[model samples]
Target: MLEEELVELRFRLGDGSDMGPIRYSSALTIAMLKERIVSEWPKDTKITPKGSTDLKLISSGKILENSQTIAQCRTPFSDLPGGLGSGGAGGGVITMHVVVQPSLTKTKTEKKVDDMPKKVTVCSCTIS
Candidate 1:
């Protein structure tokens, strides 16, 4: 797990909506966050969940790929409706979602395979 913490950025909707952005206080690592959300999202699927608090990650217009690398962290409300790269929000002052990316100081180790050869022995040879 990374040492960084993730927080959601909230924003208000349009059409006289009073709801702010729903963000998550990420107490998890970046890999865990991606794993939790990615597994539930289908390919080229847009999913919307009830309530602004819960983000379905994939929306109807969002395109997701298996080969794509998951960014450890995302800006607040980055996945919210009209949050990022959308003109619907009209470029207003939106709160930020702060997510912690995984640290790069971890070391990986590999185990070596045994070099012993297999031996076969038979007490007596049987002729069939």
Candidate 2:
């Protein structure tokens, strides 16, 4: 396939740093893109995603669904959100923002009832 036919993509972190000008087929799914992002994630970043489930990809103010294709998520250059532009030499690169979502397991810890101290109240009855 010709280079122009492929979609050029870049990933931007919450810190405003960018990842790549990697070329991909428009047919690629958002889930697949997340996998790529996880693999190419920078080691120096303070926040890291443990898996695709921990990452959220946003483009043009829309959070891309896992089932959505690259083509579906792309927007016209003029309509690009967040001041993003068509970058790269060819000028069609789409910059997607990557957000690391805290996992439910990490954010919500279950406490065992047995671990808590029981409170006991003594009832006193007085009869005249």
The runs of at least 3 residues in candidate 2 whose Cα sits more than 4 Å from the true structure, single-residue gaps closed, are 1-4, 75-91, 109-128
Question: What overall lDDT, based on C-alpha atoms, would model 1 receive against the true structure?
Answer: 0.34
Among residues 3 or more apart in sequence or in different chains, the pairs in candidate 2 whose N, CA or C atoms overlap within 3 Å are none
TM-score, candidate 2, is 0.69
TM-score of each candidate?
A: 0.21, 0.69
In model 1, what lDDT does residue 91 have? 29
The digit string of per-residue lDDT tens for model 2 on 14-85 reads 888999978887778999989999999999989999899999998878889999988677645546554333
State the C-alpha lDDT per candidate: 0.34, 0.80
lDDT string for model 1 (45-127, tens) is: 33322222233223233422323322222333356665442323342333322222222322111112234455778689789
Worst 10 residues of 2 by lDDT: 82-91
Q: Worst 10-residue stretch by lDDT in candidate 1?
A: 103-112
Each prediction's RMSD to truth: 14.3, 7.7
Model 2 residue 21 CA deviation (Å) reads 1.3
Query: By lDDT, who's the top model here?
Result: 2
